[model samples]
Target chain A: MLAFKLAFKNIFGAGYRTILNIAVLSFAFVTIIFYNGVIDGWNQQARRDTIEWEIGQGQLWHPSYDPLDYFSYQDAHGPIPEGMREEVSAGRLTPILIAQASAFPQGRMQGVLLKGIPPGQAILKIPTHELEAQDGQVPALIGKRMAQSIKMKEDDRLLLRWRDKNGAFDALEVTIAGVFDCNVPTIDGGQVWLPLAQLQEMLGMPGEATLLVAGEGFTPTGNTGWAFKDHDYLLADLNKIIQSKKGGSGVIYGLLLIIALLAIFDTQVLAIFRRQKEIGTYIALGMTRWQVVGIFTVEGAAYSILAILLGALYGGPLLWYLGKVGWAMPSGSQDMGISIAEKIYPVYGAGLIITTVLLVVVSATIVSFLPARKIARLNPTDALKGKIQ
Target chain B: MESIIQIKGLTKQFPVGAGKFTALRDISLEFHRGEFTGFVGPSGSGKTTLLNIIGSLDTPTEGEVTVLGRSIAHLTHKQSAQLRNQHLGFIFQTYNLFPVYTVYENVEFALLLQRLPTAERRKAVLDALEWVGLTDKMDSKPAQLSGGEGQRVAIARAMVKRPAILLADEPTANLDSKNSHHILQTMKQLNEELQTTFLFATHDEKVMGYLRRIISLEDGRVVKDEEIIMDKITEG
Candidate 1:
């Protein structure tokens, strides 16, 4: 306790030196926390946007379904799962039928993924409610990215071609009902949504779907003809992308840590060198060499405590302000082929805050201890004389 | 009377180039209760080295020294520190008070090291400061103090523990004549009142004049030891 008090006194007594050290460390604290908070916010926003725009609470895929393999999608369609029929009728489950097709927009041919969804279903946010089952022409909904790619627009007329279950080629003219804008690229780019029943009838395959999306708060009771995909498994690829992003950000974190520790280490070394006479005075006043060393080490470590306090003093308001206004991403960031919002709010999580604080405190203590041990080996007589050796 | 410090044939040496140079040689001395003594010498006469050995700052290279009942040569580093902390107080010529601390804090430091109770530590520190006529300068930092005042604070620090012996090395070397005489008078009065044994290593005659006994050293050997009449001694 005496060592701590004395060290505290010594640190504040150091005037500008102590303040400079504290400022450097506090800057590190704010930067580290802010960088981590942004990454966490991006991850959170990605997960949420993916959920609302693509996968709802969870997904159920056909046994043969393999999104990466187009041929497998041909075999992916099957009759509706028997157990999910009631939920499907109650609007709790939404089934989507996928097929590969091509569209001729302004006489230019472009490949597309033909997705069929219930016009009145509320399970996802695709704006398929604008779809009509039997207009004078098939009414379709396309995303802005798809519309831009095909040179099509709202209410444009186009020709879509596909094959039936029996391998017969067919074509039809469709009227674009609406163009839905979404953050999820998987749903937005090169995709067209039509009424489920109409597409089922057009393909000559009634009552078949490639996937079923459960609404929010729905739980799977048991196995149907399809395999149940929980949220984690469904978002596994996104998690991988986030983990890779965290690794990339880890380099920045490492660089910041190196810079911070170097400053602290330098300060500790300089202070110990300059205070040799004081160290000797401590020993002469009846302090054990270890106790003198403790005072020095504790004085160095106390800088971190002040840094944390200083960081909170300025960083708290800065973070809160940033959180409220959010960080506006660079324009056209959505084309990166990942789901991301235009603005991301940084989150201050307990886990992140605690981990960062612990890392800083422990590192500061270690850096302090290294130089202070040098004092213990000094001869008191030489130290009292202020001899460098 | 039992001796508080006992030194027998004590010698200290330092490595110089290839051979060793001896600082003190074949010196035997005993310091007892309430003695105000000074080791008088010129430069390189080993007065400070002898004081260092007795203060447990250095060990004798050839012989044994026992102070306050503990053998200096056999004690570990921690035990040596314990001896200094518990039974000995030191005042240096440079007045090496912690520059950042106030006069009172400087005086309170030794008591804090001993982990004395707060009330007792406060009283002892205040009393010691009063003895040195520095109670009014309790809040003055070392940088704010004059040379004599700094030395006085050092004296108060050393005496706050009321140790059995006080070791001062060139205590008046940095002070002016007036400050020197004033500090010496304070020390004389402290010796009379507290009966604290005072030992000094000095080349300053002004310091010598205040001592009750003077031991003269030359070339690592004691040449003369004489008791002085306190009434007749005068500062040159």
Candidate 2:
């Protein structure tokens, strides 16, 4: 406690210098954490979008569903194999069908991708924006781009046009109950979701969803098309897909780590140079090299704590506001019906924030030793003579 | 008399621009317990260097230095620091009281090395300040005091640890006549009351007059070592 108090007093003894050092360190901390937060935010958004569209928490597929797109559902011919139903009921499985279809809604005509889903089971696989209460049934949310192209709104009736096995235009008029804009350009512009029952009735295809993703609840035991549950593996797969879609977060983290180290190093060196005389006095007064080292290292730890607290205090709300009212997209893409929610989400996880703070403390502590070593080895006489380097 | 400090054949040299400059050379001296002694020399005559060696602030290149029966010149770096802390007190020409500390805290710092309890430390520190007649200024900083008051605070800080020897380098160099007299009287009284050995290096004639013994040096050699009765003591 005495060492800590003395170290703290020595640091703040020179008011201007201490404040200057803290300012430089705080700016450096902010820069590193900001970049770190951005990478985390981008990865989170990418992962959420990927889980919603490309893959899910886990996937269950037919036995014949191999790597080739053409080899789907050829092996397991039937009504989702009975056992997978148990997995879905236990919140471990989600069913999806990916099929191509044509959409003719008044003046808009285009071929679109259709995703058939069981909403209750789908929620377990891909997270959705939890909607508010409506009348009897939950609203069927359409992509913003799809809604804009057809000039549809809540309760507007539009025909879902597709081809049936009879080689005839099979059309069903469905109400556009809600609009969802998940900002992945491909998904928002071209896809629509329908209930599994409705999709089966319209396309005359029954008993099989194109893909089924199962989460951690079951272990596959032989030739039953059952796979073991591994949450780590599932997260890794999701992370890989996310990285491919958005970008590598590691590069940003690496750059910020280097920058933070350099900043702390510079601040500590300057502090040591400024306090060489005080260090000499301390040494002359019977403080050992190890005690002096501990003192300065603790000072570095204090600075790390202060900078992280200030950064978090300032950074959290700024990111939240950015996520809330995002920027407007460019005018040329105005026809795509871009919403504010999708463009600027700066969401972050607790683990990522904690890890970043820990890294800052470790880096600062390490950097402080460079100066502490110089101080510990200082000869009191030479140091008093002002020959400290 | 028991020797508080002994220096035999001591020499110090510094390297400067492809040449060797000797600061002290083949000096021998002994400081006895409960004595007031002064070292007088010209600039560059190495009074400060000799004092530093005695105070464990500097090491001799070619001699033996024993303080309180311990060979301080041969001690390790940490040992020398402990020697200074346990046995020696230092008063600088500028008083060297920590400017940021109040008078009480400045005195308390010397006692911090003792690891005394808080109540004992406070009592001893306040008592030391009272001995220097600066008890009223205990809460004031060094800058708030006059030159003599600041040096008194420095003296209090030095004596607070109850060190066996007090070493002062140019102790009166920065004082006016009145403050100089006050500091010398304080040191003399403390010498009589505490029986602590006081060693000083100075160019001030007034400082030398207060001493019972004088060791004068020239070119790092002790040219004169003599005892003289202090006239001010007889008058007081």
Candidate 1 residue pairs that clash: none
Question: For each candidate, what is chain B's TM-score?
Answer: 0.97, 0.96
* Predicted candidate 1 versus true structure: per-residue lDDT over A1-389, tens digit per residue: 99899999898888998898888888888888888888899899899889888899898899999988988877789999898888899888899999988888999888888899999889898888789654577899998878888888888998999988888999999999999888788998888899999889888879999999999757788778688888899899988988888888878877877777788788888887788878877887788899988887787679888989999999999998998999988878887887777888988899998888887878888898898899878888878778855
**Tens digit of lDDT per residue, candidate 1, span B1-236?**
56888989998898889999999989998889889999998989999888878888878899889998999999888998998898888999899888788999999999998899999999999999999999999999999999999999999999999888999999999999999999899888888888889999998878887888999999899999998985666542
TM-score of 2: 0.79
lDDT, residue B235, candidate 2: 54
Q: Give all candidates' CA lDDT scores.
A: 0.87, 0.69
Task: Report the Cα lDDT for candidate 1.
Answer: 0.87
- Which residue window of length 10 is worst by lDDT in model 1 chain B? B227-236
Candidate 2, residues A218-282, lDDT tens digits: the string is 45444555443344654565466545433454565566656656665776777677656556566
Superposed on all Cα atoms, the candidates' RMSDs to the truth, in angstroms, are 2.3, 5.6
**Cα-based lDDT at residue A354, candidate 1:** 89
